[model samples]
Target: MIAEATEMLLSHLVLFVLVLTRLSTLLMAMPAVGVGVPKRVRALLAITLSVLLLPTISNDLTSSTLPQIDNLIELLVAVAREALVGMLIGTVVQLLITGMQLAGELISSTGGMQLGDALDPTTRANMPALARMIGMLVTTVFIGLGGHRYMLAALMDSFQTMAPGNVILHQGMMDLVLHELSVGMSAGIRLAAPVLTALLLTNLVTGFISRTLPGLNVLAIGLNINAMAMLAVTAMAIGGASWIFSAELDVVFERIARLW
Candidate 1:
């Protein structure tokens, strides 16, 4: 009984090591949990969670001893495959957040608010204050909408559908990710359109004023008018941001759920 128990423990350990490789890779590349985090911390967290998950996911991998190969080359290849799969999924999610940042940039550009910047605590990088604000706002909405739980649920379900030994790249999923990226960029453009339109109209009016009022310093006057116009439009747009967020979140979740 003692020998049998020891053998079972060893088998579990082996399975855990394999499962951990994939989880670590995902945690390293995925957004929110991955970006700007210390590598050691990500590794520690991944190993700890993978250890907890091993028993649940072990069936997805081979329990039998590894087959003979040219040294450890094949084993390394398997590990690489697991890591690649994890990164692929994680990157898709990361790009989604990048889409949000791009939206922030477009707003800042059109609003004549690009001069403002702030340090982002979440990303630990210097970003436009507006961008940082939108980022934190999005993260808050994500939590409020229970998106994090869904992410974890997706991560857990992946083990069942994509075990270690049978790992294969899904080209169809990559295409879907590409489609989502393009859609996200378009959404950003749409979100910034109203403000941009207001700016354009303001410019046209300023140009006419310059031509008619020869005594006035039009360039100086136009700058202040542009600023005020942007402020007004931004305030108006903000009231509708929640609806935009809800619609965008629905699409994001729909795309994420299809990975399995």
Candidate 2:
């Protein structure tokens, strides 16, 4: 009887490890949770989530479908597959935030804000102030809109379909990722279009002024006008930007659900 109980406890322990692997990988890739979050805290959250999720994962498994943890090679393969699944989900959701940051980079390049580049604590990289600001704004909006909750729901549902040791890396998943990438790029361009247009017009007017009035300091005046135009257009378009991001985020979540 004691041996049977020991075997049961060992099986549960192995399942917990697998659940933790997937959860930790997913959480580490998430922008809201991973970025600027301490490693120790993330570890604790992963462990806590694993403990909570283990029972559900176990219930979902059948005796025949349980991963062959007794075999070292099979166990490693299962862990690897779980990590891949976690990364796929995380990457898909992260694309939305990347698109917003891309928009900010475009605006900065066109509006002379690139000069204010600084190290962003969240990303731990040098980024234009505008880009960093927009990244932070989108992240805040994501949390506010309960995107993180939706993300977790999607992860949970994925397990209902994609069990450990059964996550197949198929062409469909690759296509989905590529589609998200293209969408992100296009979305960035669309978000920055207004500012880009305003800056273009500002440049044209400044050029015409310089040609007609060679004595005027067109360079200095144009710089100030460009800055003002960028600020003004961005302020007016902020709401629209948020709307677009929110819509795109919804689409992202839907795609994840459909794929998984």
TM, every model: 0.81, 0.94
Q: Worst lDDT window (10 residues) for model 2?
A: 63-72
67 Cα displacement, candidate 1 (Å): 9.6
Q: Which parts of model 1 are misplaced by more than 4 Å?
A: 1-11, 36-41, 59-71, 117-126, 239-242
- Taking all chains together, the TM-score of candidate 2 against the true structure is 0.94
In the range 133-202, model 2's lDDT, one tens digit per residue, is 7878888888889987887898898888887656677787888788888887787788899999999999
List lDDT for all candidates, in order.
Answer: 0.68, 0.83
- What is candidate 1's TM-score against the reference? 0.81
**Overall local distance difference test of candidate 1:** 0.68
lDDT of 1 by residue, 83-202 (tens): 776666666655555566666687677666777877766467767776666566665666677765665666777667766545667786678679768766766566667777888899
